[model samples]
Structure formats: structure tokens, C-alpha cells
Target chain A: MKNYSNLNLMNFLTPGPSQLYFTVEDHIKKALKENICAISHRSKAFQQIVVHTISQIRQLMNIPEDYYIVFTASATEIWERIIQNLSIENSYHLVNGSFSKKFYDFSVSLKRKASKYEVALGQGFELADLPIPEQVELLCLTQNETSSGVSMPLSDIYELRKKFPNAIIAVDMVSSAPYPDLDFSQIDTAFFSVQKCFGLPAGLGVWIFNERCVEKSLALEKAGISTGTYHSISSLIKNIKNNETPETPNMLGIYLLGKVCEDMNRRTIQAIRTEISYKAGLMYYALRESKNFEIFVKEEKFRSKTVIVADVLQTPASTLINHLKEHQITVGSGYGAGKDKQIRIANFPTHSKETFELLADLLIKA
Target chain B: MKNYSNLNLMNFLTPGPSQLYFTVEDHIKKALKENICAISHRSKAFQQIVVHTISQIRQLMNIPEDYYIVFTASATEIWERIIQNLSIENSYHLVNGSFSKKFYDFSVSLKRKASKYEVALGQGFELADLPIPEQVELLCLTQNETSSGVSMPLSDIYELRKKFPNAIIAVDMVSSAPYPDLDFSQIDTAFFSVQKCFGLPAGLGVWIFNERCVEKSLALEKAGISTGTYHSISSLIKNIKNNETPETPNMLGIYLLGKVCEDMNRRTIQAIRTEISYKAGLMYYALRESKNFEIFVKEEKFRSKTVIVADVLQTPASTLINHLKEHQITVGSGYGAGKDKQIRIANFPTHSKETFELLADLLIKA
Candidate 1:
């Protein structure tokens, strides 16, 4: 533990828990002796904290009056639970990139009648490209593709809503929420990991569900599908309604989440988005001059302003990344198909010009 | 944060992160700077650390050289992953209590053909009462039933191993791993939450798998029943072989876990087990004299030496528990079936005689 503190070199560039706030870390240490361990998950005090935090999140998201937000392990865990609970008959998943494709595959793995309307990589799934659903039970989309560093055109979701009036639409905003233009009213269920834009640790995933989705779950329960006993939507609903979780949660992470949320509310989500845009703006401009680099996802308008995906030109990305690593700088490799051809640079809100410039200098030197 | 250190009344009695060592908490705080935020899961340094930890855990558990260990979110998450990854054809789950029942239900939910041999609450599982499978793919057992405070007789497992040589056996030792008799050779996979006996936070679950289970997973892969791609047994195998996780792990938790392992290594497992026994003995004797208190689980041999479950004889357990709360003493409630009927007194190694005396005095007055 002591040696790690003295290392002085090493950078964490992979997305999420972008960087821990010293204030929050200190707060958790102080909380260690504060009776957090002995309290039952079902206790009124702990329940009140859960309720308050959920309510605070709802306010932050500007969720619809009828919507409810619940917490889970991570966005990935919710991916599985969504299939286990909400897929009653069939699920129509829209796949534009790697992450959404994984979701579609997960649904199929669960033996659900799942179909996908996929667009080519570096392309957005236009409303025209989505197939007409025959009795669609759930509509799934990744609002922001963390893997591809792209955000779906918001208008496409609105267009889909017009076609499937009764379908329960679920969106993954793991990298989008706590950013701008994330309207919660249009979707039935939206999930995000608090670690990304929220700037907390990797443990908690926040899920916001509309009344329609809740009704569908109740209907499924009445019909005896049972969904599941643990990760079921109904069980989550009950826990949220009572302001508690069914099991003991990752309390420290949740506590830090509350702190992160409080900090965000003070700073404003728009400010964070503006900061992300600034970082991306600086990075996009710097990478353009380097003949060895090119952005992967085609349209700049649809590309994620928070995460920049760049393709390597002459040199292998590994070489450039290793050059940066020599200076104790860190960045991520492109996921899946983008692999060696691309590199991902996350411009988290807390990341500063000094850090971004440090990377730019290294890339230029390389 | 400073106020918590100054305050004399704060007592963290919750299940986990029960109370972090000051040094452990400080290391995490300092790591949040620029170092950890940039480290990659694929880095050789991180991989080596992971390998070292796994090797240490193997040595501590007395695991055979061929067996391996994998890490997960929590022991609860492993319950689902275990049945999903290992159960190929049929499984026999011995459900003696809540945690065991939940594991059985999860198997059934996964569409796995599962059989349950259950015993009444507070009574530990006996091999004689369970149906010995003619051909079992895997056997599931929870060594320590946290909710009911009963540990399935270890002798039963030894006897079953002799009678059923081919069946792979899995055990949930979340609340029992800190103490003795963790012979990994007899069991196929033994999992535990780091927060329990490990005395850390609740993010990591340590799973030790036998060579047979690994072979079976590979066979299942060849037969096309690959556990979901992201959660494949092969990914875990690759990770364990290299001493790293396939995904981004809780690095801070891993550091704390290493510290815990070092602390445990300072004293032999027998010495640590003795301390646990000493603390449990203190709590048991304190409760023995109270006319209104009786052990929740009947047999002393089957009792969890780490967690004492005591039922209120003539009064509501919650009422007495609430009385103790005023004095800043914290204790857990009976989980699942024992809810409202029993008080759980955790005999964590760090908890001393002074802590026990405070609780005993409060209970005597109440």
C-alpha cells in the first residue's frame, strides 16, 4: 500500500472512475467508523439514504413525474437483468456498433426471440434503417456507444417512439448521462454507470424506469413469467419503492456517488458537458495535424464529445501508446473491430488542459 | 472527514468495510492522484500483482498446485456465475438456508435442470439426508449460511467426496474463509466475499476452482454451451493463469486485499482461527447468562464461530437490539427466515474483548 503511493508514475486512462476526488476518498475513510457496517439494508435510516440519493438522481436527470430510478451493480449487470426481467415475448435491439451488438447477442443467448437492425460501423442507425417491429416487446438502443466513441442521433429515438407507441424502450447512457440533451421523458427505461460522467467508482449503475415499463413488469408478474427472484424488475421496483435494496449494496460506492452527484449539481451538468467539449475540441484539433492519426467514427456531429476515437496512420497504435506510456501517460486501445487501427482518448470532465496537453506533447514527440 | 476522526461516538458496525485500517484508507486516498487512474488492466505490473495475490491465496487455502483462483464483483454475483459457468448437464444444490436457497433458485432461473436437497432452518445439511446423484455434473453447497448462521458440516463434504468421486463440488465460504479447514483439494470451487473474512470492502469475490471444473468448462465450450462471451470460464482461466481479471477490476480493493493477505500471512491460519474462536467464545458466554437469550442455531458444532446468532427468549430481538443502539453498539438482525427473531453478533478478528464487554453490559441491563 505504501509503495504504491510512492510510485509517482502510471496513469489510469481507461474510462470510468475517470479520477477519484480526494475529498470523496477522505469522506469514505471518515465514514468507516460511522455505523455503516452494522445497519441492516432494510433499516429505515439506510432506506432513507437510498431514497434520498435516488430522488437526487431523478432531479439531476430531470426525469418524468412518473419515472423511478434504482441502483444496481454496473451497466453490464443491468444488461443481463433487463433481458431476464423485461423480455416477455421478444426484444428488438438496434445495433450500430460493438456494445449494442453485445446487448443483442445477450438477449439471444437468453433464448429470447431477439432481432437486430444494424448499421455499418462509423455510421449512425437512422430511423429509416430500423425495421418495423412485429409485436415488439422491448426496444433497445445504446444512446452513446462507449466502444465506438459515438452517440446515436437523438432524433432517431423520437422517430422510433412514434412507430412503436406501446414498446418499452431501453437505452444505455453509460457515457451520455450527466451530459447535455439527455431527455429522460422520451424513453421507458434508461441505464448509466455512475463511474463515467458521474465521476464516481465502477460499482453503481443507475436505472431510471418510466411508469409504462413498471406496468409491463407488473403485467408479466401477473402472467406468471416471474422474470426472476433476485435481479427481477419487480424486485428492484419494490426495493426502490421502499427506499432500500433487497440485498446489501456496494455502500461505499453509493456514498461516493451521492458526493459526486452533489458536486455535479453545484457545478451543473451543462458545465461538465462544456468542459468535455473543450477537451475534445483541443484533442481533435491536435490530432488533425498528425499525419499518423485520423478519427474513426465518420461524422464529427455524431461522435462522442467526451471520448475521442482516432485511427493511427503510419505507425501502429501500440507504438504511439507505448511512447506515451514512457512518459507515464495513459490512453485506451480501440475496442473490438477498431482494435489496432484505432485508439480511444477519454476527455472526462475532471481532466484538465495540462493532462490533455501532456498527451498531445507525447503524441507530437512520437 | 476530520470530524469523524475526532468524534468518539461513531461506530461502523455494518457488514463490510466494517472498519478500514487507517493505512489502507490512506493508501487509497493517495492512489487517487494520477497513478491508479492511468493503469491498464493489461499492464504487466498489474498482472504480476494479481498473480502474486492468487498464488498467496492458493498457499493460504492449501489448494493443490493445479487449482486456480478468479475474482468477481461479490460472492452474491459468483453464485449466479458459478451455476451458469460450471453446470453442464445436471446439478444437485444442497439448500439448507437462505443463501443456499437463493443459489438453487438462480440455477433454476438459468434454465438448468437442478435438484435441491434442503434441510430445515437452523439445522445444518447432512449428506445422509441429501440424495446422492447417480450422475451429478456439479454439487452446490454453502459452507456458511450467513442469514441463518449455520455452516454445513464439513465432514459431510469429505464423506461425499469419497462416495462421489466424479462430481465437481462448489462451496460458498463467504463467512467462513477467515478461519480453518479451507482444503481446496476436496472442493471444485470455493468462493468467498473479500468483505467478510478478508475484512475489506464488498467489491471483490475470490473464487478458487479445481482442475476438474476447468476441464469441464473447456468441454462445455467445445460442446457449444459457452457461458456468455464476456463471462466465459475461459476468460477467468486466462485471467487466473496470468494473475489478472479480464475486465477492469476494483484496483483499490485488490490493494487492500493484498494487505489483508499479508496480515494473515504474518500469523499462521491456525493462529488467526484461534483469535476468531476466542472472540466468538466471549460473545457466546456473555449471551449464555442472559435468561432471554438463546443461540438461534441449536448445534454448537454447526454454528459459525465467526458470527454468533442469538434469539431473544422472552422479548423481541429487535427491541433489545434497539436498546443497545442508544449506547452506540451495533449488531445485525436475523436475515431471511430468522428475521425479527434473532440478533447476529459478528466475531470479526479486530473486534476485541472491550467491544464484547460493552455489548454484554447493554444486553444484561436490557
Candidate 2:
């Protein structure tokens, strides 16, 4: 087992692509020295890396043994894949923020009859208010919406399983993954990029799905539906059995992800998750109690424990962003139309409890 | 400029994802220290990195100023993108090997009317032999086929543009770029992965397309056709103009690519191309003279300058592969079904003339 919790300067609290995993730099050095990236994707050595990485991920995240893990360029790619492979006639989206809305948009873009129950930004979907859409074969959910820092509570997210029993549930954990403690049995498929909670670089999306998604994907192909090429679910499953991808994937990213996952497993994800709770609590409390900022998500349970969104008061978001920059801290400003008004702060595993305490102190007075 | 020509043992002569560029290690070290990977893709700092990287790529490759350089996960993604965006009716492919055939396959998978004039393995197409397809909107060509170590000579590749004057020419330079000295005027679009000639890691793919391809993409989008989403041609162009991608991309890959390109530019691509020619000659000469092996491609003109494939005559490919491994040298086994029958040797810019000379001497006995 490797060590963890190396303190670094310059706190990056952006939602996704926030900070490098503490051990990632060390892992990268090892990879480069061994020419790990130069190895053929088909090589036995590459296969070992793929197998070890997936195994660590599964063990760390408690992903079921039956779930198949695949790699794609980004979580954004998964949006298209889910729509193309799992859904035929219609897809339902519980949209709250931009990232969730994009999943719905992708279904529509793929020419599927995509129906979305969109709430106000920074709000979560309530099971009681959600309308059951007709003939929806895929139910899309963003467990953690990065753009608005809204989170659908796990209970609410899993409760949809009963309502949308016939549909494939695809969860987007672009901002918060491995941290969500998701019930994989309840969620048929889920996807995430490394940059968010994993604290790895962008690129290298991890797409995990059970047999149901694969059966649906195979059915789609049988019906002459284009489930995509290269990194399609079918091809990914076929290639992954040999510990390879249909295309040469993000080898270095995978290498680092494996090492990072291993390191997280060393500290234990449970420990990391517990630390995340404390850090998220401190940051959210600071923002909620601040004179200069107010919590963006009004509902207590709706706010994401990973990404905390705050409405900047009596100042542009840039002021707070710059204020933190002076302290060598970086926090993301509001996304899209709320760019000048909201400040989104990430409380990822890469963020230390001590560092979060410092950031919370800074936020309290800023 | 930083110096190069460092001596390193344990040579990797695989086609793509060969040895990392000599300077890549230093650049990666610097990137890790500077927290380059941790930077936000939307930050001005990240925008500068993207701009600088794209600018360096354009200048190093002498790509036209009008050409739009976009990044994808792999060259495989570009094939699907080209079919989805540029070809609405028919895509004519000049297929000889696995990689080129996959490009045609992607068109078929996308449900495009893909026509191909496939020559024998290790053979290049003659202009007279091609049966021109009707209503072809895209003409696809692989300048260098990594699978069979065959290259369609630039003259022959450019000749197709004159023959199919109206169709968008999308060239696959997956294993050959910057070394090709490609005439941008004759090719509407071309793509290559960094792991090949660029000698970076495997994740980042550089997709270069001229205004014509973008115009076709826009026309297709205007016609309400699904041109895909996220990294769509239209979205890529729009996002790139703002120095952003529609999604958070391979930040570390882009950073390393920029530094590596800068190193290549400092050394000058002309010098690299000259070295590639010389090293390629030495490799081909070694293979041709060897009693144990024979050149895979019979035609001299069709032989790739970057990847040299040779038939294993007496011994299994592994025997010769193991023989080289004994000397701390690694070479690629033949691709696909030919794995035991052939050995492919990479002759990228990173492969030094001195190293190739040593390998050539070793191959004389193997």
C-alpha cells in the first residue's frame, strides 16, 4: 500500500478537473520511466494494467463483480452512447443543471424522443412531482450535477428504479463519482470522468454497466440501430474480456487512474468519503454563513456534498475568484448565465481536510 | 531551445505509441511541477495552453493557417466524426489494411453508403484501378497504413484529389504526420494520434480539417442530420475559437503535445523528416537483406517510411521478437492474423539513426 494525503499549495475548487490526485504525480513518473504508455494496448503488460485498474476501481467503489467497466474519451461521450445503445423510442431525463440537461439534449440530438422534467437550476427532482413519460426505454439521472452543484439524494435517485422499472437507469456522475456510494443494482449503468472526484486529469471516462445495458445494446444492434462504433458497449465488452479496447485508449490516463485508485483503496474509499463529508460540511457552512455569499441550492438535501454552489452577494463572482487567487486558491465561477453571480466550490477527495479548513476560513471573511 | 539526442536503451519500435519523444519526459516533469494538468480547461491559462499547442502544431506541421485543428481521443474517433459530419451520401475509401478498412467500416457503422476499392494487403492503389463510386461526398485515404506497413505515396494520395475534385478528401495520417509534408490544399481533412509520429502518449488525437470539411459539416447540420454532439465539427470549431472544448479534454496530453511539438519545431520537421527517411531506409535495407525475413510490401513506393513490416520466413515472429528483446530492443509483432508470420518495426522521428543502425545490425542475424 502507498501513502496518501500529501499537502499541496494552490487549492483548486473547480467542479471537474479540480486537482490532481496526491499520488498521481508519482504514478506518472513511474509510468514514464517504465515506458508504460509506449506498450501496445494488446500486450499482456497492457492487459495487466487494464485488469488491475478495473479491479481496483471495482473494489474501491464497490462495483458489483458482474458489472462491466469500459473506457471512453469523456463522460460526454457516454451520454451519446447510452442514448444510442440503450434507448430506442424515448429517453427520460431528470434534468436539474447543465450537465444533466446535456444528457437529455444528446438523446434529442441522436433523434430519440427525449423527454425531460427540468427543474430550476440548483434543484433536485422530487419523485412525487416527476411525470412518467410514455415508452421511455432509458431513464437518465445526474446524481451530482456539476454545473449547478445540485445533487439528487441517493434515496431519491434509487427510488426512481421502482417508478421506471422497465427503463434502463443511466447515472451521470461526471462531478461526483466513486464518492456517490451508488447502488449499482438500482442503477443499470453509470459513467464518470477522472478529473472530478478522482482528482485525475481530464479524458478517460469510466463507463460501468450491468448485463441489462449490454442486453439492450445487443438488442439495439439486432434491430439495426447504430449503437456507435469503436467504443460501443458491445465492442467495449468484447475487447475488455481480453483487457483491451476496440481502439487504443488513454493509456497514460488509465495508468494514473489505476495508481490513484490503488492509493485511494490504500487509504480506503470509506475514509476518503468520510473526509469528504467533513470538508463538504465545513465549506457549505462557510458559504451559508458568509455575508458575501449564500448557498445556491436552497434545499439542504439538494445541495451536492461534492460541489457546493454559492450565490455571490453584493459582488461579482470574479471578485471572490480573484480574492481566492491571491491566496493561491482557485474556485470556479457560476456556470453559463449565472457566471457573474455564482461561485462553485468543489470538495473532492484530493482536497484535504486541513486545506478545506483554510478555504472555509478564507470564504468566511471574503 | 532544449537539447535532444539523448541515448536510451530498451528501444520500442511499435508502429503507434512507440517510444516517447526524447524531450517528452522533461516536458512531463515540468508539467507535473507546474500543476499543468490541474489547471481548469476554461481558465485563461488553459486557453493559452490550447492556443499555444494548436499554434505549435500548425507551424510544426506547416498546416495551413485556414485549417482548423481539433483534438479527439484517438484517430478512430475522427473516422466516425468524418462520416457523421462530412459524408451524407457516399464515402469512398482506399482500403488496403486494417486501419484503412476500419475507416470504411466506421462509415458503414454510421449507416453511410460506404464504397471501397480495397487492394491486396501490403499493396497501394493505382489511380487507374479505382472504380469511382457515384455520389461520393467523401474520399478517404490512409497516407500510412500501420497494419501492413504500406503507405500511399503523397503523389498518389494527392492525385486522388484531382480525380475526385468535388469530394471532401479525409486522409488518415494516424501513423504518419508532420513526417508526410502533406499538401493541405489537396486534403480537406487529416488526423493523427500523438502516440505515432508525434511520439507523445496514446490519448490525444489531432484532427486537422480545412474550411471545406467544416462547410460540409454545417450544411449537414443545417439539413437536420445528426452530426453527433459534444465534439461535433460545428461545436469543436465554436469551442476552439474560445480556446475551449465542448467537454474537458486531455489536458496533460495537450500540454505534452505542445511541448513535444515545440521541441520538434526547434529541431525543425524538415530535419526530422530527413532522419525518418534515412532511418526508414536502413530498416527496410536490413529487412530486405535478412535471410530470416523479407519486406512485407513488395512495391518500394508503397512501403511506409515510418513503419517497416517484414515477413518472418523460418522462425515464428515471437522467436525473432524474443531475439530483439534479448538485446533490450522491442519490436511489434505483426497485426491481426499475421501476428506470428510478420514483425513490424516503427521508424518514427523519435527513433534515432544511431539506434536504427544498431537494430539493423541485430536484425541481420535475427
Evaluated against the true chain A, what TM-score does chain A of model 1 have? 0.92
Model 1 per-residue lDDT tens digits across residues B41-145: 565656656766776676676778887777777777777777767988678888777888888887876668889888887888656667767698888888888
Worst 10 residues of 1 chain B by lDDT: B1-10
Native-to-model Cα distance after best TM-score fit, residue A116 in candidate 1, in Å: 3.8
TM-score of each candidate structure, all chains considered together: 0.88, 0.96
Give the best candidate by lDDT.
2
lDDT, candidate 2, B1-366, per-residue tens: 001112135788888778888888888887776777777788777888888899999999888899999999999899889899998878999899999999999988888888998888999888887898645789999999999999988998778887888989888998888888888988899999999888888988889998888889999888889999887898899999898888889988998898888888999988998899999888888887888888999989888898899999975889889888777778999988889999999988888888899899998867
Please, what are the lDDT tens digits per residue for candidate 2 over residues A75-152?
Answer: 988898889899878898888888888899998888998898989997777788889674578888898988899888
Q: Please tell me the TM-score of chain B in candidate 2 relative to the true structure's chain B.
A: 0.96
Model 1 local distance difference test score: 0.71
